[model samples]
Target: MTIATELASPSPSAAAASSASSADSASGAAPAVPPLLVPKGEYPRPDLDRSERWQSLNGEWDFSSIDGEARITVPFAWETPASGIERTWLEAATYRRALAVPASWADARVVLCFGAVHHRATVSIDGVVVGTHVGGYTSFEFDVTSHLTAGRDAVLEVAVESPADKRSIVHGKQRSIPRDDYDGVSFTPTSGIWQSVWVEARGRTYARSVTLRGDSLKGIDVAVELAGDAPAGAAVRTRVLGEGAAPAAGVATDARAESATDAAGGLHPVDAELRLTADAAGRASGRLEIGSPQLWSPADPHLYRVEVIVGEGAGADRVVATTGLRSLEWNDGGLRLNGDRLYLRGVLDQGYWPETGLTAPSDEALLADLDLARELGYTMVRKHLKLEEPRWLHRADELGMLVWAEPAAPSRFSPEAAALFEDQLEPMVRRDGNHPSIVVWGLYNEEWGLDWDIPGSRRRAEAAAHAYDTMAALDHTRPLVENSGWAHVKSDLVDWHYYEPDPATWAENVRDLATGVREAFPVKLGPDFVVDKSLYGSDEFPRTGVPLLNSEYGEGYTSLERAWHLRWQTQELRRHDRYSGYVYTELADVEHENAGLLDADRRRKDWGGLRPADVNADTVLVVDLVPRAAGADIEVPLEAFELTVRVSHHGADAVAGRVEAAWIAAGAPLPASPHGEASSAAVPAVSPFVLGAPVTLTIEPPAASARLALFFVDETDAVRARSYLDAAPVEAPNRRGARPAPTPAP
Candidate 1:
């Protein structure tokens, strides 16, 4: 929607960078494969990385599915055209691939890992059952050291079942039986083996996982988990580097440049080392203090390089991670990060692509979404109903994008389904909680698993509460919302979703919801039906003294009119100082949902030649005029119109700027050129006006149509925000169709 083209296209170099980190390139065991099936050879785990010790099994694999047996791509689901098995979703499938054990990895333990497998997966190596994983949205792994001999090939078989009855499992936007479910918002299924599968070599007594807990005022608490035959008193050494060091040695130059710079551009964070001893359970933790720490936020996402080593040199394990040192809290009825008020000018990201389903085409594809978010002037993005790839979160850390992470939810209510929902929270938190970009964790959305009857069923309310407590135990640093958008069973913030087409009414409801004057949220369950705002909330979570945000708000449609609705709807959000922030319905089109700034192909719509950031910037100009029909031009008086304008500044400091206005006729040059070029002088410019002041706009009405454009320019003469008003001259009643003359005579 914005004119800036900062996102990079997926290139062969990106794929090479990923595979080069793996040992397969050195061993030369992987067969030459078609680029179409193996579009990406990227590393799946940038966090907690031991890149060189791993081998990618992400290219071609022997595959079969319910839709009929065929060869398929490893990470691409069959439902997508990219997967050679381009057919309808298959509920069951079996994959067989050859796993070559490099002779150099003989002394280390070989662990098989899956970024994720749909619904249910049973894995076996060399005819021996290794492990089974349920819940498709979380990562799982197994150690297969005993089954394989060094330099020999082993058969890796994975049998997967993604039941058609998705109501019993955690499926995000993926559709199941009753295809019209989710109000027709569900999409093609992301079935088995949809994410990367790989094997990494680790020491027999190595660090399996490391958690970094960072605080700007204090320091970092490094927690290490060791697996395999670890000694009773195993020790872990933690070293956090300053701004310039790479995460590890032998990494590519592009990756090194990514890790070396801090977006905050502040003083270098403390570089130091601390050691801790593991007990019988093989756990170790220690805190490293930084005298002056650089905090991470959307404005500046500065990551601290962390390296941890376990055991001694001969049989040691090493892991490199990038951690952000930051802190957030509630203050003045709003969320604050790094002691500054945080207004989440956010967009809802569904994390889907036309060809890749949910899997990324390349590592750059993940960064492209964050790049789009930054271009649109969004400070945050609410990942709707999906747990995205770790590379996405890692790029958010690099590019300074805040995230509100939510996992997939079930479609129906049942005790078993509720347990499945509860079971998924721990892994979600454990996997994602360390990232500073993720400011909040959401469990369920709109009571989907509770059959949307949170008010009627006590059992449903208990399920929501159980999830709240489960996540509270795993993570306390970030805010937790049990049920987002309505009926907050247990949450740190009271957020709601109201999709009102009328700007005046949306403004009224948003102010009321923010002030507690309105307790119930208006629900638009479907196009033909409307449920009035009746259900306020249950008694489980109190609403008093909490931050209020409209987590979702927008109308459904496409193009300039859609952009028009986004502008007005979000204006109401920024107008109310009582509110914290807002997340628009979406960033890109998904399946049947057309309420997106960009299409499913990630291309901008025809927004009437306007930049989307004009209305979405952190510091924007809000004009006080309710919109008329979105596609139609307003019939203003022949000469002039009066309106009030104000600055809605959410930056860390107060805003200082001048507001400029100009009127240009149809087919005229934009105000962007020199103050008055020949083409631009068809209309005139208005004198500068102070913000928050009423100003009269005058125009010598052109014979055709015209547009009144406004801009907010800071002291540096750079335009920070811009808006437009389409107008046509008012016409008198038709004289030819004169029944009026006869009525006057009578």
Candidate 2:
């Protein structure tokens, strides 16, 4: 049953409801029309925004697939609950809508835009096929000026086909029936239009495209591609309205200016604007500097308001955007952001939602996820497999969050799949190149599209290297990870993924990998399969003098145990001064993998007594105690207990600090020096030292059950780090097999 009957006009107020709807989504509440039959109303393209001339076509649409017929939303995939038709996967679908170009814009050109559609999409207006676009994760557009009927409504239809097979296409983490290599990690497939769709009326002569880049905090460069009637004499003029800093609290101003600001208040007038004349191709580019340069970082993400106008006056094309200044460098010592040594406290973000699948329920939901990641004390999030939505990247820029972005990858090795994967690279980079928050571009994950055999296949290794070279050539501002997690044939930073659960074995293996003691390392792909990794790709592209990072690790049957592993395994990484950074298994759990700190719904899981923020902070105390299990505590008999203490400091400057030791008991008076100053000698920066003269604390008195605590207090009397051990005295011999006495209350 094909359903393409004409639908009624959309509500006039639907466009204005986006903000209120977003507010509802922020509080875990459902919006009015929600994602169904109503536009999310966000201008999808902030980089090249022309809000005054565009209209959203996101509200209502008639959808029919082979499996069924229903009214579906434009952006949400039919497989998601937000789509209004939670149908299962299908090969093909048709979307129909009725739109009319405003007659007042008769002299203008109307173009249809689809932010993204999975697999393939064929667009048509008034029964005439206009264009066809392939690939799932990237956006596409078409000019529909000739097909439009001006003031009268015209029937618009889109045909979408997403294949059942996963091998040939660059699918990333999206999964179908017959699973792919990463089946265990893959989530639900997104089919049909899964992002915003709209129509924009452009001037007769307009800017076709624009690009902005940060020139290492000194200045910014801009380029514009003009089209339509624009000629060689026409020019692209760029002006800085202000710097990248938000306004003060409670100030009413432009949302764009407000969201990108810091206390520095980067609103300075530019005395002069830079203009570049278009060549025969109607392309122009030039460099310009800001009044007061401020670099972007997690501490302060300042943005400068750059407006690029083509030609002049009211009919001219204008693109208002924001950019941040920053520089990145990676070497044997580690990564540096603006010349300051930085550690990547990162987590994996799969970019899936419970209700929306690949689409976020709302813009707030997007920000909320980043907020949650920051709450977990993560400085960077590796967008695994998928190139995240640009809005996610934009929000990351506003919040000063760093990103490790990767494009969608084809599952198998084939000329077709490789070509398809290569086809996706330039678009992905160009779409996201302007964002300052993105610091690294990952070409492949574990050699996924190359049959997971970069070492064995020379062609595959070259393909990976070629991908790296392509990305590096386009954007030399950031490092390129040829293949993350393992088998880095060509990479700016060398990273490996390990999931050894045992503390002793994990530390030993980490030390081996960090120290280059082992030529070959085993990569645990799943519960059954393991492959020995080599550096065959390094023969041609040497990466011997690169920084090392544990891009992925941690495995636990339960969340508490995972948190426990996170607590100590992180210390083990910091134990060696060689490690540049580490990214835990994930920030939020995906479908079947429960290794994330947060559950699938983006809610925090029970971590027992552990606090993730405390363990993940920049500065922390690492105690030398390896427990067999997370629930396993300590045992004592009225005797002395000894342990070593070390400081893992990533602060900007060194501080002289001493270790403070104390004892805590349940429902009992506090023991002495329990609050007194630590007896350990003061040491500056990150160094290991023994607490007390002989590094031993004697348990004196009534053999009371208690836990001893340690703290690192700096010379300024500020406590920089702390840790504690729960111990109870051993009980008298009994038939119960010498169980320890119950822990006392403090």
Candidate 3:
């Protein structure tokens, strides 16, 4: 959390006149031009304390083609509209920009930062090499303090080369296609400064890195690292803020801190704490306490905020960070959070934007996801191998959305691929570890990493397992999901995949193989195709006593209207009592996978007829049990009008159960088991019941219906199974509206 406030010192807009041709600008035309999209919005990092004086170099920059006869936009690759260049490929490109340094920065150290650059990038200022950085997901900075001239403008240039198909780097889901196979979509690779670029001034000694850890029993511990030279008696102070206006502060001696002096004098380590307090705002505070703290449960999430101040002997800068305090433990029972059994109602989130592809439409678009999850009764989301921008995590923390962060794995597992995965994944975790929303680290998905039966596959699995263990050991605060969907080895949780409509089929399989074998089984089933099941369970589950969970289900692509469909389907399925919980196929659609609850544009489909349960006071008929003794009776309540009940029994003697109906308000005893068959003792206004165990009952109130309880009983009162029929208000069909459409196959 770095906070840098600067007075509005207007600079020349990127839209200023340039000599480049329009064909090379973000908007491709006759004259190639430069990208004019400046980074004027608030910088993403507000938690970090930064200087007030700064400038953005993100907009238009001078450009020249590195290869061939094509010319393109400065920052945007030749392939995107925002770049004003639509060339499909760029083997090499050079970008240049000029900025006038203010006389105020003459005596101050100057630093240049690039939000992101694809593949490899080299930076040069005034034709002198300054710095270089690899990898596209992380940010890099260079201290250009020595290359500054007072009141004189500086020329900054960058050379970029990216073969989007290269497997050596972490490209996430970017694809490479034949030259002529381009589709009219924004799925092409984005290169070079897709994010903001700015310059900030730092004090002689500044805080480098901060790591915050919390233990439920021992409270929170803060570790801070500082950079640059520190005086002998330097001290670092940290403050904790929440609902209270004032913050609590803690001080530590700089002499005891571990310094990254050899490596650019960056701070490597510094530890402080705030005990749990009742005044903490829980999830509302944007911060919380640790000791005996209200743990961050899926049902009720809580987070804490930490502020760090670095003083050189006495005068230092300050930074702020928001984090959640909780712990994850893996035992024979399964994954547990805060010492409680945790069930992951998760969705595979594919971070994609219809307009910007990997880039989000806006910060609001990111926050909308968490809000949607809360509405749908989900608490967790798997990032699905893609690392998101930091702002995404910030929203997750604020919305209390738990995250399973996975590193993108190569399609094939080669020795080189393994090295690449390790290289990129380690830094990703270290950079994102501070966020409380990230609870699980997923190593591999399915067979993405290695061949299941190959000789070397075992070693790969072992190495992956060891890597998972190492991450857990490094920060035991979160659980490690060794492999997701398939390929379970020596891991903590047993994860599996199934793609069948019948949930009971897989449930029985697990029962026969694990519990029936009577052997020690630590594997927990992670069903991938459970969302499509119509009947969650069958007769086999009652006999086998197998415990099953709905790990994956409901992946229908989201549309505005589909929201109603989801509510309808969810209500219909919960009555079965077979699934533990459901993890929908996806949170957002990525590429061609349209099975997302949200569209690529991040807009919710309009569900016209169906309303949120809260807004519409419609009562649903929930039948707890279907069949009982013929002489026994059932009970139902009136809430909504629609009623449908299915009864099934185990015995051949259908006469064992009976349904005797009664209207409690009218004081009239009605006939038992209405509909299907006629009985000898028939009461007025009551339908008869059949001798069969499973009898279908349909009750349509004849216009005059009251808020009354309907009771069904047998002679002995032994068959006490009940069904509830709620009275629903009549809904008028919308003749002006379109007809109801059929639900699409998931």
lDDT of 3 by residue, 1-746 (tens): 01111212112121111211211332321121122234333445543424234565655666667544433333344456656555556756777777554543443445676656766778888888776766665566675655645346678877777674544344555554431111221246666556556775543344556666655534556655554334233355554554322322232212212231223354322223332211111111112233355555445556665665555322244456656667776654345567654555566676666555555545576667777766645677777666776667777876778887876655455667666666655456545777777877777665454533222355666656666776666666665655555444434444444433323343344343333342222222232312221111112212233223334444123453234234333333333333323355666666676666656765554433232322111112223333211111223333323333323221212323344332332222222334322222321221111112223344434333322233333445443333222223444455887878899999
Query: Stretches of candidate 3 above 4 Å error?
Result: 1-40, 47-56, 66-78, 99-111, 149-152, 177-187, 230-234, 242-302, 313-315, 451-456, 501-582, 606-746
What is the C-alpha RMSD, rounded to one decimal, of candidate 1?
9.1
Ranking by TM-score: 1, 2, 3
Kindly indicate the candidate among 1 and 2 with the higher TM-score. 1
Give lDDT tens digits, candidate 2, residues 298-341.
89998766777666553455556767788888875578888877
Error of 2 at 383 (Å): 1.3
Q: Clash pairs of candidate 1?
A: none
lDDT values, one for every candidate: 0.72, 0.72, 0.48
Give per-residue lDDT, candidate 3, residue 336. 58
What root-mean-square deviation over C-alphas does model 2 reach? 9.3
**Candidate 1 least-lDDT 10 residues:** 1-10
* Per-model tally of clashing residue pairs: 0, 12, 62
Candidate ranking (lDDT, best to worst): 1, 2, 3
How far residue 696's Cα lies from its native spot in candidate 3, in Å, is: 11
- Could you give candidate 1's per-residue lDDT for residues 391-423 as a string of tens digits? 888888887889999988887888888888878
Q: What is the lDDT for 158 in model 3?
A: 79
Candidate 2 lDDT score at position 406? 87
Candidate 1: lDDT over CA atoms? 0.72
